[model samples]
Target: MENMLQNINSLGLETSLTLDDIPNIDLYMDQVIQLFENNFNDSKRNQEDKILTKTMINNYAKGKLIFPIQNKKYSREHLILMSLIYQLKGALSINDIKVTLSDINQKIINDEIDLDSFYTSYLQLTGQNVIDLKKDMEERVKDVKKEISEAKEEDSGNLEQVLMISSLVHMSNLYRRVAEKLVDELVVDKEGKRQK
Candidate 1:
């Protein structure tokens, strides 16, 4: 159990890709899949897990979550949009992700910010947040461990497991609430424009 906890703690310390790691050139579907697979390898829970598929990419385009491929090639903008979808899909509904991405796409279309600048800014902000989240998780783990140590003998084992699960649930809830709020903000803004 301790070893399992240690492994969980060490999980995301190694597998993230920075903005510079993303290729600037347009890539074919297979190359795009390979790029995502290599960068977000940790996302797969098992060997058979598919991270991103051609069908899924097509679906995203059809769903308007991503721009349509150009001349059968995906640009860096497509990669960035797909990456955002990958990260958010676990915690957000497809509609919520669509709303968020739509807002971003509108901004890009308006020239409020170009894709490269937006992607760079996103990477910087999210990288720092990930670091902060890691530190918070470590502290939570330590606190849980200390509490478990002080727990009565018969309760310590189950208590440790429960505490870890509770921490994870709490974090998930926090992220979900934030996502919902952002989605709500987008809805409100859209509604405001419609009323004008």
Candidate 2:
């Protein structure tokens, strides 16, 4: 169990492209697809899973989750927006993502924030959170191991299963709370008042 935990901890680190990594020149659809594929290839769960697809890109554009293409080409801003959408989609509903990104998109359009600045800040914030989460996971593992050790012999077999389920439920609840807070911050009431 210790060896397994160590191996899991040593798994490849999650990575994101920096602002400098995105091409300055506008990219055609195929180029955009290829870029996303290259970056997100590791995220695929199976051979049948696609990191990004043309249909998904088109759907994002259609759903206003990303900026509309200009002259059949995507700008750096588009790539950044798409990347944000990709990351959030796994944890958020489409409508939630749309609301959050639409707010950001408006800010970009109004020149309130440049894509470079926004993406940089996002990377910094999330990178820090990732570090914190790793520490939290380590602590949780230790706590679970201790709990399992203290369980009655007859109950020992089920302790690990209980811990796994409890951990997943806790994590899901945490995600829900964060998502709700984000929605509260981004979405306005019907009378045009900010909920937060």
Candidate 3:
């Protein structure tokens, strides 16, 4: 029980790829697949889980999520974009991701924004978010333990685990709802028009 509670604090500990982690040279499909598999091995949920597949990459290309490929090779920007897509896919649908990316792709293509600086800032924000999330989850766990210390609930031994998982799932769901709302409100449609 203590072990499960302790491990809950480490939920958001997955590391991100720094800019230096991406290759500057173009990558073929095989190399792209290998790179993601190698770098994000811990991100897999199961032993047979694949971080990225050729078919998925092809689908992303067809959907224009990773735009502006050249000579059947993925550039540094493509890898970064793919990484971003992978990170957000859990929360956002493919159409939502494409809509969110549309403006970013245009900005990159027009050289209106610096991708490196933006990506670096995003990484920093993500790191801070993880720290904050762990702190919040830890506090919640402590509160859960204290609140149920004297309760005579059935299956009381596992109540703490059940409560903790419920809290985490509900928190995740609320946050995901907020993200979806923001995407719907702020991201443009395929025709490059805002929905609201």
Candidate 4:
């Protein structure tokens, strides 16, 4: 079992920007766009895929997904909020993200909480989540292999591939559903307007 775990490499899940990677000084909108593009270039699905755009940033501001900018320059807190928006946009609706981040943004704007310290803690949590995900993937594969243990070598190999794909898909869906549920519960629907 240990050998099997050793030989099988789980998918990489640690891709993210550290606080050190962000500029300490405030940056203009174009500079912010460039930073995100450079940092996320490796994660792009295609050459033409954009990490961030002026229009998108404008829309985020219009939609209140991010805090107001100062003199067309975005602070470190703004960058952090944008980063969170970019990431959560994939799994959650824009409205849901706005609802989720609004309180944090308020705390940041009002100086009620230190955004840097909070982001550091968030980064730590993200790292731990990656570790947990890899461990769960290994266990998922092991369970699939155990189920097909009686098959011949060739048949078992093919069966393992199928089972592994199925297991991974189901696991991903289960996690996504739980995340959505957490979002639903965390954000109270005002005027009965629930977000996706």
| Tens digits of lDDT, candidate 2, 111-174 | 7877798789999997887677677767777777787888745666467767856986889789
Best by TM-score: 3
Residues 1-196 of candidate 3: C-alpha lDDT, one tens digit per residue: 5665356444435566779989889999999999888888765667698989999899898998877789999988889899899898988899889878877888878879888999999999988887787677668878778767868675666898888788889888999999898788764344355333
Give RMSD to native, each candidate.
2.4, 2.9, 2.7, 4.2
Q: Taking the candidates one at a time, how many backbone clashes does each contain?
A: 0, 0, 0, 0
**What lDDT does candidate 4 reach at residue 81?**
90
Name the best candidate (by lDDT).
Answer: 3
- Model 1, 1-196: lDDT tens per residue? 4555466555653455566777888999999899988887774677688888999898898999986678989887788899889888989988899988997776655667577777778778877876787667677878888877877557677788788889889889997998799898999999999999
Alpha-carbon TM-score of each model against the true structure: 0.86, 0.85, 0.89, 0.80
Candidate 2 RMSD to the correct structure: 2.9
Better of 1 and 3 by lDDT: 3
**Worst 10-residue lDDT window, candidate 2:** 4-13
Flag the better candidate by TM-score, 3 or 4: 3
Candidate 4 least-lDDT 10 residues: 4-13
Ranking of candidates on TM-score, top first: 3, 1, 2, 4
User: Per-model C-alpha lDDT, please?
Assistant: 0.80, 0.77, 0.82, 0.79
